[model samples]
Target: MPLTFIDIERQKNWRIVLFFLVLMALYLLAAALFFAALLPGPLSAEPRFWVFLVIAAALTASIHFWFSASNAVDTVVRRLNAQPPDLKDDVHRMFANIIQELHVVTGAKRNIRCAVIPSLSLNALAAADLKGNAVIAITEGLLSRLSRPQVEAVVAHEAHHILSGDCLETTVAASIFGTFSSAMEKVRYSSSNRLFASPAFLLAWVLLQLGYLVNLFISREREYRADAAAVRMTRNPLALAETLHFLSRGWRGAGFIGSGFEMLCIVNPVATTLDETEGFLPDLLSTHPPIKKRLEILLQMARVSITELDANAERRSGRKGTDAQERYFVMSPARLWQGPFTAGELDALPWLSPLTWVANGKGKTAERAWKDPLLNTIFLRRLAGDGRIESGFTCPVCKQPLVTAAYEGTQIVQCGFCAGTLVENGRIPRIIARTGRERPCTERLNALARSVLQQNQARNIYRKVAARGAGQVPLLPCPKCKNPMFRGFYSTAHLIEVDRCSNCGLTWFDQDELEMLQCLIENRLLPDITVAVKD
Candidate 1:
């Protein structure tokens, strides 16, 4: 095993040459078979015919190889819709800084460009082409969620791949046949006809299968090598270990990242049983090793166990709550004083605001919540996240001015107090497309989603059987149009209750409803249609 970057073995260019030769052989065989089936004469016995076939196959292979490998970096960046890191943005700036730091540490071996994929998937990839262009692209979700050290570890891992020259070979391999395979997949899904029966489709499928054969040449051990190199560079095995753990539980771009690009990514975007298991066949077929094994190896290096790592993560994420010594009493909306509550508990109250009357303890003098320094931080944080811009519209529920807040890279008006959001109909698809592994679908949210779906399902059934409309519920006035909005399920398919104003083309999602809808769709949680209903 290489202990230093200088010790890493240089990739043999002959491997790429061999790959080209194999591609030519496949093309030649395919062409010969194709012509033999169509022509009646013994074409194989004719020397001139053989010569012409060889030249045709060689030309075709050369074109395919050059087209796929020449501009691979650009091809991949375009496919993922990656953009250069926004130097003005904090997170993007930090990512850019890290890439610069990587360059400095490596003595500027290669001027690797950096890009940010506008996806919410937690995956990063490195691509190097024959043009000597190399780029490291990370998803927005990963950059936002990972700490600086964790992000450094990920960048280092991808950088090592590029520096060691494996990235170029892998890019070429994925490009040659994988690109066509991915294109064919999209075509197959989009077409309504029997695309599988098409001769062109069959040929592409054959080539795609042959593309998988390239994985045989690309060793899974490269990932382990990259991981080791990253650790050597960062000198923080625990950070990478924690990141691997987080990624294992989070979404890794299953549907968003295209096929055949898995080998280039730090982790397989699409999880497979073969990827997580180890054996003779898996070793030969899988492009990545088991994440669990990787984690164990890293944890050993860090001198920590998985349990400790989990505990540390929980503490960092604030999942492990602690008992608060200082408590405050707050006046409820009903003009009654609520019992003493911790600051954390107070923050959870939707109605609690800076103007709300609060006391340090039972009989203490009541003052505005903001007067207390501890409670003021909550409001300050809220303002920082959701109060940057005040939208003209008011919240339908809170009757307070809505703030323009960023959600999934799009702007939406949200109530700072009630946390309700008002979004235009046109922006809904963009928001949903952007929502992915950024936030985990908690069990609480999942349970609420399932219950809501079941209730909506039952309600629909009752309305259909009784030949009556939905039961009357108090409708909130539309923020944009002051008219009462229609409250109903977002769709029959999703069944998440939402308020919509037909005149304004706006929708209101109360508190957690928007996240619930995103969770429902992300996990594909369906309503139990067989649920019993009572009149």
Candidate 2:
């Protein structure tokens, strides 16, 4: 290829193509010389022989290049997670800006994409699609270090890879050359002895080494092209240059891959251990172009002074009044995973059983109660079976005595004295939470409330009696509310007694009390719940 064109940013006048034409021709000549050396002597000067050799060598080179680049793409990709990104805010917006600018500056027809890795490692790379899926990934560290413009510049470069079809070239190369690289890795890893002398295979070994270096050279060329494309799009080369400078500076030893792949990223290899930047040869095959040269290109953009970005983050410290990320609580945590739907609504969801909602709801309830460190049904249920407590409970509302009824494997205490119901499931609906929001005198209620309280206190003492006697004295202390429990023969269960708590209106029952309570509620038993007529 002859010198056709080049678009230099420093002078926006004369467009020059074939800017790398000399380099290309020089590389072609070198390729020819190398092939002439590698092939057999008999066909050395033959035209048809040279032609066949050229085609074979070129084809092999193409496949090796494609596989190598593809494998590198795959390697870095496997190192990454391919999931929908939960992006950092600024980085997300920067990617958006990059896409927008790429379209505006270079008219990239495709959409830009991104993914996040939770790792705090400072690195980023672009991977071309073998199948033409141009995806650009930015790191969490990119967000932490680079300002909006710098990030935008990085994205623009990646987008440039997409826009200029560098991804196509790279993807092809990686797909072909990456296969050879995999074999290289197998040999490198499988060798038991640290070293192998290959005098007979010297040229093969050297070619293998050259293959590694060639892959790097391809990576370096793509980066330069991407860099130039990025500047062309952003018109802000300085930011990209500055971003690269700081990017490599902060990246120390982190991900431990062969440094051979370092040039594939926007910065140095994460494991880089050198400060020598001026030497071009040290970084000649380096994927990242020199920051100084890049900055020179960036100075072409209007001189913009660098201002220090704020590094001190406002972390959430659980102080009483400090501003923090605001949170919202739905009806339950189950709603969060099941997604903004009520427990009942969750029952009808596809691929989910109706019963699942129940378990998830219970788990959510337990989690909330445990986090709260307050009294709840779990503690209340602990007092259920002590003999001193009676089977019947009174509704705190109606003051009418209530009996236990099971609904769908759960117990509800329903008031006989009034039309009040306590589900005992810890869910007082909004109507309920608001209905009796006013704190009643914990000390008093009307006659109906009082009757219930009396039964409650009796139940507490009866539990104590039963726990202590185990069927003998029939009187004991209520471990639940720490109130006294005593024995009293209720007609429903004259055969046994249970414990109850007076202060907290809890009743204990012997195991059969549920049946006994049902009998009492059905008017089958004449318990000593004799009524006092109001005057």
Candidate 3:
């Protein structure tokens, strides 16, 4: 018979009890050893001493366990700097909605709160405390990038952990010893040389090792149970499978998620060799089952092979099968009609602009390049590069005077108010090539660049699949020509959207978009195609 939530919850109670008993035993052993070292005699023969030690150990263990586990949810929230989802933000709003839906679906069995961790790493964790508090926290990077269904799958997976009572157990275990480990890490990094030889430091180190005992109790199989429960709850095994594949390849918050908390996460934040291997030792020691095995199970339930899933994911990452074969004729600077050229050839022409008259072929009516929707994107690409010269142009978005700014040794007009930039078509290549010389890309900028690229790639895939463009934002007029600029991706390959003026040969990037573009090119960050494809 399939296990229900009630059945899972009941079975977990014994495990939690066992954890407490084991914790008391560890404390008793430690106390007995400490007394033996101090007294210089065997205390095992003394019944009164044994009784006193037992009582003291039980009291100490009770205090330690309660203090650590009672406020675990709050402790985790503070440590992660997680905040409640902002209702005003679209992505955060969607997350909040999913939590509400979860509450309804689960019959409000527990009041589970939702939070968003500000880090850009992809990971999510659940925490529950003895105070009846439960929270599902997802990193901003993961939350912003996943589809609605994928997010649903992740949330359900976490929810199952909370409802099954394992989250509480894990939180308690982590709190009991993980707290000391975290403190020791800080002390080890920040303390003086003398502190390393201190007795307190040695005690903390021993406690840190004892924390690993908690991991022994944290069966890797619980993750499989959660995956199955998530599927049962969401009825979308494929979504969960895709999410796992994505997480397995991407950054999973290794340095940021903290140690001793891996058991609480959907995927082990730190991907260890043991977590990916299957053996009696790994099965006994690891906190998460192998991702490949988890994916196999989920894919089987979804009734699809790993190959088909990978292909679908590839398409979603904006990998096209074939390039479009449209050709065009152009009106040259000398006013003579040029022969039919591919879009690539048209882009190479220096004089091509919105006002340039162009024809499709023999009988097609001649029209301005800007009027041809397909050819207009060529101008947008032209604007993506860097250029300098003050033409007394005002910012399209901020209405402030544009200042000539030197970026990568080239001149570009930038808005002092909004920090947006206007670059001419000719300077983009120079700017891209000159990146990382004077201005090295910071880790924050690189992360942002990858995130923006992934978002645009997903948007592009959606546009192609739906056969429609995304909802249009208000168009910005050209600072020079006063004509509305064309808004679109820089190119199919780059996928960074920018506004270009076909008339004036200009492009505008809002705020950090220009920097993100440069960083992307410098780092060669591509769409997330590293999805695991193990059988």
Top lDDT hit: 1
Query: For candidate 2, lDDT tens digit of each residue in 1-535?
Result: 1111123222221111221233233333334444554443543365887787667666655554445444544455565663335445655665655556655554344555565544556666666654455566666766656777777788777765555554544444344334444554565566544223322224435554554444433434556666776776666776776776566456532553234434445665553333224455545544455555565555556464333211211121234234432221233434544344443343334333211222222235413221221212222232352222323553332222345654334555543323234433142222223322332223222333344434644554565555543445535444333445644543333333335454654444443343333333333233345433223
Candidate 1: tens digits of C-alpha lDDT, residues 1-535: 5566665535555666776577557655554444333344553376888778668766766787788799999999998999999899999999999999988888777889999999999999999999999999999999999999999999999998888888988898777656556555666777656555555446656755775877776778889989999999999999999999999988999878877788999899988999999988898888899999999999999999999999998887774244335778999999999968988899899889866889986466998776788887887677667537778897776455678888888888888877888889999888777766466779999899889888888888888888887547678999987999998889989988899999999999988899889888888999887878766
Tens digits of per-residue lDDT for model 3, 124-168: 999999998999999999998899999999999999899888898
**RMSD (Å) per prediction:** 23.2, 13.9, 23.3
Clashing pairs in 3: 382-425, 385-428, 386-427, 386-428, 387-411, 388-411
1 or 2: which has the higher lDDT? 1
Q: Stretches of candidate 3 above 4 Å error?
A: 9-12, 27-64, 186-204, 319-371, 374-535
Give the candidates in order of TM-score, highest first.
1, 3, 2
Assess candidate 1 and give its lDDT: 0.83
lDDT of 1 at 174: 71
After superposition, the stretches of candidate 1 with alpha carbons farther than 4 Å from their true spots are 9-14, 27-54, 186-204, 319-535
How many clashing pairs per prediction, in order?
Answer: 0, 59, 6
